[model samples]
Target: MKISAELRAFSGRLGHDFARPELLQRALTHGSIASTTRPDNQRLEFLGDRVLGLTMAEALFSADRAASEGQLAPRYNALVKGETCAAVAREIGLGDVLKLGRSEMLSGGRRKEALLADALEAVIAAIYLDAGLEAARGVILKHWADRLKNVDSDSRDAKTVLQEWAQANGMTPPRYVQTARSGPDHAPEFEITVRLDDGREAIASGQGTKRSIEQAAAQALLDRIEGTT
Candidate 1:
């Protein structure tokens, strides 16, 4: 099957020429635009998530022969997480080729983190199906080479790092409390305070989604904890 010039360009960007061009098309198609004749990427995304994890795990294991599983696990997670996949998708301009429904397009589905990440994973699965493990690994390693080089020893997010520290110390998980919220509905600023079981706490304020604000609070508390250690 012949694909559009845009998809042919996307195939170039993805660094994989398709033997089964339909696979590439399905990989770029979202559920919103799926029909009886056209399938979505959900199944592809599911398979691709495992493909990504395995590729990253192998890369991390090989890169650090002396590192423990604990160290490798977080680094592996940091590499394959939705945020990281979305970043890679953006880097490759995957959003420009995505096929979305009208509502999804209007809501900026192409720019949505979850959508981008899922689509990227789907694309990986498509590559694997079209070629083989080596081909998929080559693509993943090529795209993730820089991240592999620069990944932190403990690449987990601040919240996860803090939670694990608390657990290791036999303390309950850190809790985030929202003290205040300001600004209009569309754009709001939030103040969050993260408190540990030991009564130690730190405050932070940010403007974004609630999760980002909570992360800021957690990072503040982690900074304080690390400073004294």
Candidate 2:
């Protein structure tokens, strides 16, 4: 089958020319558009998640000999999280080539974080199937080079750090409350508040799922407390 110019360009950006182009096609297909003939990327996404985790884990272990498992765990999580994957997808323009159903297209599915992240994982799996583990690792490291180098900055998520701080200080866990949600059903902005038992609190707004917004709010509070941002 002749690959489209767009898919060809995407393959270039992805740094892997698929021997089996159908894998790439399947990876780009979304559940919204899936049929018996066109399989969605869900299974690929599942496999890619594990592939990504293993790649990151090995990279982190090799990069930091002095760092203990305690330190490496969080860095691995930061690198493999959905948000990070979505950011990488955006960098590669993965969203532009996504094959979405009509409803998804109308609902701004191309820009959705979850969709972008999932597609990226599926693409990783596609590359793995087409090539090998080394190929998959090379692609992941190429895209995540900067993040891996600066992994110290994001070693722990804001929520995790905040919880650790609270526990250390003998306070209860932080509470996250969604104050408001606005926008169309397809896209929404969330206003969330993160409160500590000791009365310290912070409010922040983000565009995406409630969990992400809540995490952003917690991060905001942590930044304020730590005077980092």
Candidate 3:
């Protein structure tokens, strides 16, 4: 599909233009479909992930002069986390612009937070490739400045945040239950259902080692409750 119109308009909204829109396309393409067809977005994702980290670190440094490296790490993680990235992607209609295979499209890949996050990172990499690091930093600063201002750049991990929220509300500690486990034992994808004593449950699905799944589940629960409150 010819994506120039969409790319051009998106670039304009981003306050920059891409000399090569194909890079943008490759950045937004998900591996599910693009693995066999094209280079896919993974490489861009790798590059964009670093770009996002560096951009966020710079923002934190400029905004919080008193913060130490330890203090800034978690804050940086929160801003550039998958959920935050997905939110930004949604804000700019990245999901709609994404090119998916028939199967992925039918499966609602456009709405998946992980896919949205990955695509956003790819787009960042694309912008970086098209223009320069400064251009990409401008885009990040434009979209994410507000979040950077509001969230504590020195906050702890999501699990800690979730626990604190539960404690503050006088509720029992949050429980993470393994609702479904799929894929091979060597490479399992866990579907965790996090429940609060207050009769609320938020499910998070993640593919990883056991430890990572636990963290993903906790992060999912934290986001769900945070959104509600």
> lDDT (0-100) at residue 228 of candidate 1?
96
Instruction: Give one digit per residue, the lDDT tens place, for model 2 in 47-113.
Output: 9999999999999999989999899988998899889999999999999999999999999999999
Pairwise TM-score winner, candidates 1 and 2: 2
lDDT of each: 0.89, 0.92, 0.80
Residue by residue across 1-229, what tens digits does model 3's lDDT show? 3657777787776676777878987987777677665778988998999999999988889988998888887888789888789888888888888879897887677877778898889889988999999999999999997898776732456667777889999998888888898865544678877788988877777664455566677777777776876
Instruction: Return the top candidate by TM-score.
Output: 2
Residue runs of model 2 more than 4 Å from their true location after superposition: 163-175, 195-201
Better of 1 and 3 by TM-score: 1
Candidate 2: RMSD to truth: 2.5
CA lDDT of 51 in candidate 3?
Answer: 94
Candidate 1 residue lDDT tens string, 1-229 = 9889999898888899999999999999999999999999999999999999999988888888999988888788879988789889999999999999998897777877779999999999999999999999999999998999989843758888889999999999998889999876545678998898899999988665678778778888888888999
Model 2 lDDT, residue 218, Cα: 82
Report how far residue 157 has shifted in candidate 1, in Å.
2.3
lDDT of 3 at 21: 76
